[model samples]
Target: MKRSVLFAVLFSLSLHAFAIDTKLMVRAKAKDAKFVGSSIGGAHIIVRNTINGQILAEGITTGSTGNTGLIMKTPKDRFAQLADDKTAGFLAVVDISEPTFVRVEVISPISRKNAQVHASTELWLIPGKDILGDGVVLEIPGFVIDILTPNTHQYIPLESIKSTGLDVKANIVMMCGCPIEKGGIWDSEVMEVKAVVKKDGQVFGELTLANPSRNLFEGNVKIDGAGSYQVLVYAYNPTTGNTGVDIINCVVTE
Candidate 1:
């Protein structure tokens, strides 16, 4: 009886020791742009076991954003590899005794809080199997919009608002930190940027923002002797249906 129990314990230990290293590559790609990589403070990656709520691996991606021509110009075929070895990716190697299901989460452009995107997916990871070469691309949809004028929670006098009006200016960029310019890659002309104004929680008007230079949109909002004003600036790409927004609240004191 003692020998049998000892054998059982040893077998169990052996079985548990038979763990294999599984590799998984995760990449965060902008909706209409390149991959989110080191230049833009690479994406934060988290890998967790769904069953036990245990974290397997966590780190940030490091590499280039990826090739522009291959990602933007080339006609992609099914299973065509768009990312090369230099492209940014977070490779998580987890040791597992059996097939385990995991949830992968990615927060991209980690440097920009206002433009960060959280995306996740679940998949089964087989022991000893590796997923690489453009594996599990998470698409982040939106622009990074920052309101440059009329700072949040700022105070302005009503006289100044009625005299010169509020100059609305914003800086907008892709999730990958790609620049939006006129007649260039990621064209600004194809995008529509505007500021939605509100006074005392009521709709005031909308101001169309025109691109004066690369990644800069400027416009003027006419305030009706403002009370409490809220400005919501947004960038929309109708072609790809990608959009982003930033908001600010300013008090127009008498």
Candidate 2:
């Protein structure tokens, strides 16, 4: 009789050890006004059962004007095995017995030119161990942009740009060097700027804005330098008006 009781108790504990709850959040946007090629502005959220690598549930959000958001939930144990893999990019994992929700964000850019202007959603997930029973935490220090110019007039400081739904605070630094002849220029007339969210200091999500060049430059600018420079962009809280800075570095070649 005692043996039967012990067996049942162990079985219950085993089942509880592998349980979990998960959630996801997502957003996306476009960079340029032209919106050329296969640039479909949309966001998708997914939850997978890590034990067997099976997709449990998925959701999507999209917009033509350039922004979207979504939320989802699932069991905690569904991703327990996946948490052990460093390359998995799992931000946070909850206890198998407790209810957990993992939030995810996906933001796609319209083009490489747009990527330079906004660089939206480039924040990465910085994983840490020994917390919440070996789970991951999300961190986003912000996005960075590097600009190379032929002269000081071409410099676009981060503080000069404007963003929707987020505040802008940026750090700009100039490196001394000579100018490059016809090498530091892009074909696009306008560029898009993007901002992504960071849980801890790593990028977890992003958003892109159209025609960022209007805010960055007042008139036609030229690049004539062979040095390096950096521009940082931060996620601003629209309600609080608090600004965060993202960083970008650029190299000009002669």
Candidate 3:
């Protein structure tokens, strides 16, 4: 009898050790394109243990469909996860003792044959407990520019960027002779410009570039809505015509 009781106790503990709860769901859309070859409409999910920087689990799904659900387990009470949906992509989850930070990367693939073949990645985080009331969501949109030297000036609207959550500060970085400005001409209504620097799509640092200029401006701005933002960078001289402006990096810090 004693041996049987000990055996049952150990078995119960072992089952509980590996139990996991689904914490996040991700979705992707391939706009203006069809789901072709393995290279297109393909997506994957990855989970990581944030505390020790170890990967917990990973899997793949189809982007042509709707949202793909991802579940992960935690060793401790506090945890974080990063999710990416693209070719050669992964999602990561992390565990932290205190309030910690993690990174998320979303890659939008464009077809060389068709510039309109744009891919967008969306992520959602589901909390396990009610410790943090009304969890915050941050969003950052991606952009691409194709310009020909000598007379291809274009103004990419910042409103084209998209995100699902709040608390995301936008950061802008650019090269020389790129005229990047943000603000409204009437009553200071021009949308505020935020700066974010990201590695692998996860936000590391943030600043606000309100009515920013070419001086590498940085500051903090509050996000009022949840959606896409267009990142605009133009040539200071229209006569120079069509100099390419690259939005080298962006990040969201919460």
Best by TM-score: 1
Ranking by lDDT: 1, 3, 2
Q: Give lDDT tens digits, candidate 2, residues 23-45.
A: 23232322211111123322243
Q: Please provide, for model 3 over 127-165, each residue's C-alpha lDDT reduced to its tens digit, 9 standing for 90 to 100.
A: 332222112222212222332211122322234332322
Quantify all predictions' global Cα lDDT against the true fold.
Answer: 0.91, 0.30, 0.31
Candidate RMSDs in Å, in order, are 2.6, 17.5, 19.4
Provide the TM-score for each candidate, comma-separated.
0.91, 0.25, 0.26
lDDT of 1 by residue, 1-254 (tens): 99999999999899878998989999999998999999989999999999998999999989998999999999999989999999999999998999999999999888888888899999999999999989989999999899999898999888877868888889998998889999989998888889999999998989889998999998997776758888999988899999999999989888
* Stronger candidate by lDDT (1 vs 2): 1
* Predicted structure 1: lDDT: 0.91
Please state the error at residue 9 of candidate 1 in Å: 9.2
Q: If the candidates were sorted by their TM-score against the true structure, best first, what order would they fall in?
A: 1, 3, 2
Assess candidate 3 and give its TM-score to the true structure: 0.26
